[model samples]
Target: MGGNGKFHKWKIFYRPSPSKSDETHRREPPPKEFICPICECLMFDPVVVSSGETFDRLCVRVCRDLNFTPSLSDGSIPDFSTVIPNLAFKSTIVNWCSKSSAAPPQPPDYSSVERIVRGLMSRQGGAEEGKSRIRCTEMELIDAVAEMPDVNLSHAVTELAHRVNHFYSSSSEESVVMTTNPPTPLPLATRPACLSLSSASTSDEILNPNPNSEDEEFVAKFNSHDVYEQEQGVVALRKITRSDEHCRISLCTPRLLSALKPLLISRYVAVQANAVAVLVNLSLEKTNKIKIVRSGIVPPLIDVLKGGFSESQEHAAGALFSLSLEDDNKTVIGVLGALPPLLHSLRSESERTRQDSALALYHLSHILTNRLKLVKLGAIPTLLVMLQSGDLAGRVLLVLWNLANCAEGRSAMLDQNAVEVLVGMLRRNEFDSESIRENCVAALYALGHGSLRFKGLAKEAGAIEVLKEVEKGGSERAREKARRILLMLRGREDGEEGDRDGILELGGLSRTRHRVGGGVGKNATIANSTEF
Candidate 1:
């Protein structure tokens, strides 16, 4: 937005005055100067959609930001990719607005509440607008509507809310509406009530439409809604969640969560991706995290992980990553069967998917209960495959390091030949970050505490040479761990047998294969002192 002074003058000049002329009064023509369909004002930075309608670039950009698809006549929608700059119109509007500063003020055509909300919900144009602009516009329009006292205003709000809801559902309407041209406006009585807020029930109840065929006609309508709206609607929800604390608090209601639950399982790819994105942001607040878990989103999210577009998988994994930070969520996610798909994601072609999944795994592994669960679920082999692939080395190493804390995990690793991989990584010495080497050393140290089979496996793989090299030049922590591993290996070679079952203690926490009595059991106390 520019200086309001010039813009205010421009607005006054462009809008028609009541007493300008008899000819203008008798048969008024729509403004020859193109008015923005969005703000209903003279276009400054004029741009045109493929439909031949021109609007302020900023207004059109707001549409793009919302992911709303612009509807056109003839039952067709223009591909945003075809939107172009109106260079000639831009020159004209700029000159007109510049000269209008000297013209007299006239009453502007205030857009109706319905129009304002519709514009907010309309498909986004091709150009991207700033988040600040979108937020400001949303706040101004919502505030304006809220200030109105007319009963019709409430009716309009209810109508608009329903329309917006229909715009997001996973129903059949989306497909039909998207393929057809924009339809003629229906009489008020004929309009569907997809998001109607009834006086008989609370907003939360209205928000919770039936998951299995909402006990109403509109829920079926929801099942048959347009695809474009479904995509943009969730995108808008994602934006709202990240807008500000006030907005986030308002948007993260039980009603809203109920609404979003079906979207996680939506047939629409963008809908699923954006829904996961919103969940990821919502889970940042502790209260929201609890609410999200309770909403039973984990199972559907795992479904997305198992089979979704690469981008959606990333978002689902990211959401899980955020949720995994809470202890309660860890058990719930494990019980709900989120691990297998997560393991599957580690094998995805998309680096971001792998990264997000690995991060989620790392966080979940922090919970002592999840470590054994992960190991038993065949995490060791999957992790070994990831390690051999050479991507996510640091992340994988840290997760492996955590898993190696217990005997079952260590034995699983030994069975998976993790010693060879750890020694191989140490032998490379080409790492840019010392953390990678440190994790490798920590894991090796954990393996070294296993039975004689483990130590022989390491020594057989030339661990002594790599340990000496790392001890000489690695980070101080790596150096210390490497030295300890070398000493342990050499001591064993020298016929010294000292606590072979216990892992080497790193600093305060003894780093060994296992704690004295801490083994993998339902009540096992896996030490909480381990740090990556």
Candidate 2:
């Protein structure tokens, strides 16, 4: 579905002939050395008749046995005594077979579908399942289904969705509940607030496997095992992801997500994590955000973020971050108490977990209400530590900038000595990107707006010289900001003129755009030089 005409580099097999009119000349077929005269398939156990015609040994033997006189290519009877095995042809067949076997296995075709069906049946009760039990995982089966032709795959998805819908509707609540493990109570601080929230809730034509009977039977068997069902659900989700945008939107139904939520309580960490990962991927499409959030995925996801394994926590944080992009979901996540775990993740050993946590905080802190909660949870000190050493310095700085927007946040930053850290970042040549410097200077400006003590703190941390250099040579946005901070430090405004050594409004400026994360569309304007 995503095909584009950019495959010229992959056109390695053919070079178009310069003579376009050469279509009049037909190309000859390949040499017969690779073909067999009788039984037509690629030569295997080939024998050369006395007439020097090559035929499959089994075909010749069958013909000879079926008739008293088997006519050869020369129309002469061949004596069984004269027919010796064609050693060279046999050797060629052996070599061909060897090479074929050594090559990597191609993607599954019709036969693979048959194998997958057999595996499913064997899981129910089939002899072949034992023989090939180790061959394909549930994930591999889902991948193979997704790789089917577009029409067949879409049909498969639709059929599977219908079956899931049926199972959900027909099965009693008690039955479904019995299939899942009892939910473990989350910690008081991390427990989901939405626990009782009433949330509104592949392939092939013969390469087309039988969807109803096999899928139904397999799902019925899968229902008895929580881990297996979670695996199946995860694979189904992964298959949807491999499809096109339209397909993803179509398959990510509320019923499907509702069916998956119970799997979060499974004893298997892999299952819980995979379910959250699927939700994260599905939530990337903005239209799906409300459906997922309303599906009651938020509570379980927050629970996973709170205490699941590191991988699961990372995905949960990412999901929350993306969901928070929709304005309504920000309060939903924040009220559920997502801040503590997200803050804890900032100190996690896994870099991915740390970054996802920071990103979530970056979004959460954008809310004025959230900033107060975050500062209370000690976000300022944690962010300062991360700003100094974490990989998400730019993100950390942006969050700090957001917090610096209000009086309470400004108080928190002042308490955390944020000015010293931000100034230190400005002073390091290696630490300065346009975003980093701009945020640093703006933050310093915010922190130093009215507090002489902070102004002194910044100067002690080498901010004045950095501001002078920024005013002279940094981006225009940074320069203007530096001009403002310098003016604040010098106790003057744009109209005030000064001597050569004193701060002055620099002119002939190079204009440039500067945007801090999460504050892009809002004012690029800093708070008043007297707000603090």
Candidate 3:
């Protein structure tokens, strides 16, 4: 009975064998959506373009760099103007890879993709040349005419002139017979000949003349495979856009921006530096600011800030500062992680980079979200260090004033012992510009208003003595803020509610809230008063 039970268990656990066809069959390839339209490789970083087509980010960048547009299977051209990440498609590709037990796709090397694009461009060029060869050919049909004897040509010309005169005379007589010979005008026959010649000249000009030929040539050089040519292209663009406002507006097209995008992060120092400098020029026009940001150029600018050549980093910081002047770009710049690098750049050995980075931070920190981000990134400590070192003191103070407007910033400032730094600067009269002194006082005022801890920190730093001096000798704006800060600090000392009530009832620092140098409110004092 035991043997029979064991046999029964074996029979119950038995399974069917696999067929030969099943073993021989292979896994299917990944779906087409996984492939980049430009590189024809499995996409790792898929981004959707304006035309609603998905492509690898690197692939799109290469296309923009080369100024090459590939035709899709449906014969549509993908718009390379703007691109945003396609997170849903990327997640799908990952899932598909996992289920198939296949290695996930990785971004193809940029050079390899570039080579592929160049090849496609070459092939397309050859085909287009073949189709337009006859039309574009410069054959000299006049040579045959020139070869004829002079006598025969003269005779032919005379014969044609005789027939034209006869036709004109006949028409003129008819006109004379019909009307009372109204002042004899140029013959109708001559009119056709003249009109034909004028139309021919106009058509020739329209077909052959190009006013922007120089700019177009420069733009074409950027698409060259040679790095030197690319460098020359960027240098020429920089020069043209620097002084010519018209060129700045005209060259700020989507196509040119697309071509200039990749070179902004070029590995070559000259190329990257000049490319970013050109971007700075392009961004000088107010209209180009938002367009440049929309072209997805900010990320490369940020990358330049983080790791580019020193010269390129300076231009990158300047470019960011230029872009930040536009209110629409402030949130975008901060959101794309520019705050930390800009903060980090404050300590750079290059003075221009430090100043530009500081100014950029000042403008960007005006946004509430950006102020919070700066605080979270520990900017207060760095700014305090730079402030005490007297590197870009006025600009650094402006950034601190903006930070003082936010609650998180105020807390961060208190935590970083900012009160002592400002008080010490005031007591020592370290600033050269009265505006900087005023900014210092305004920042302290903001800190006092936002956080109660400011009272304790200021008292420890002997802020009362510094405020008295500022009240006595500083500008009217500085004196007012100084008195208000003194009242807040003095209120803390007297332990009297009326002291607090008087501080508030003194119009709640009404003079500080008045517009200073066209400033709208208390917060605008630093932004408007200091000209970084």
Give each model's whole-structure lDDT: 0.55, 0.53, 0.65
RMSD of each: 26.8, 28.4, 23.5
Q: Write the per-residue lDDT of candidate 2 for residues 423-467, one digit (tens) a residue.
A: 777777454345455656666666665566776777777778987
Lowest summed lDDT window (length 10), candidate 3: 189-198
The better candidate by lDDT, 2 or 3, is 3
What ranges in model 3 sit over 4 Å off?
1-215, 492-532
TM per prediction: 0.51, 0.51, 0.56
Which candidate do you rate higher for TM-score, 2 or 3?
3
Any residue pairs clashing in model 3, and if so which?
Answer: none
Deviation from native of the Cα of residue 119 in model 3, angstroms: 31
Model 3, range 1-532, lDDT digits (tens) per residue? 7666654544456577766556435666879878887778788999866444678999888877766667677765555655677766789999998887667998589899999988877777866434321111011211211211222211111001111211111111111111122122111111111000011111111122133554566567677878767766776666555455667777887668767877776666656777887787777666777778766677767778887877678778878887787788887677666899999988888766776778788778879878888888888888898899988787787788778877788888888888899999999997666656777887788788745778888999999888999899987767877887888877743223222223223221322333323434424422111100
Please list all clashing residue pairs in model 2, or write none if there are none.
Answer: 204-207, 204-208, 205-208
455 in model 2: Cα distance from truth in Å?
Answer: 3.2
> For candidate 1, lDDT tens digit of each residue in 12-57?
4576656656544565333555666556666656665433356566
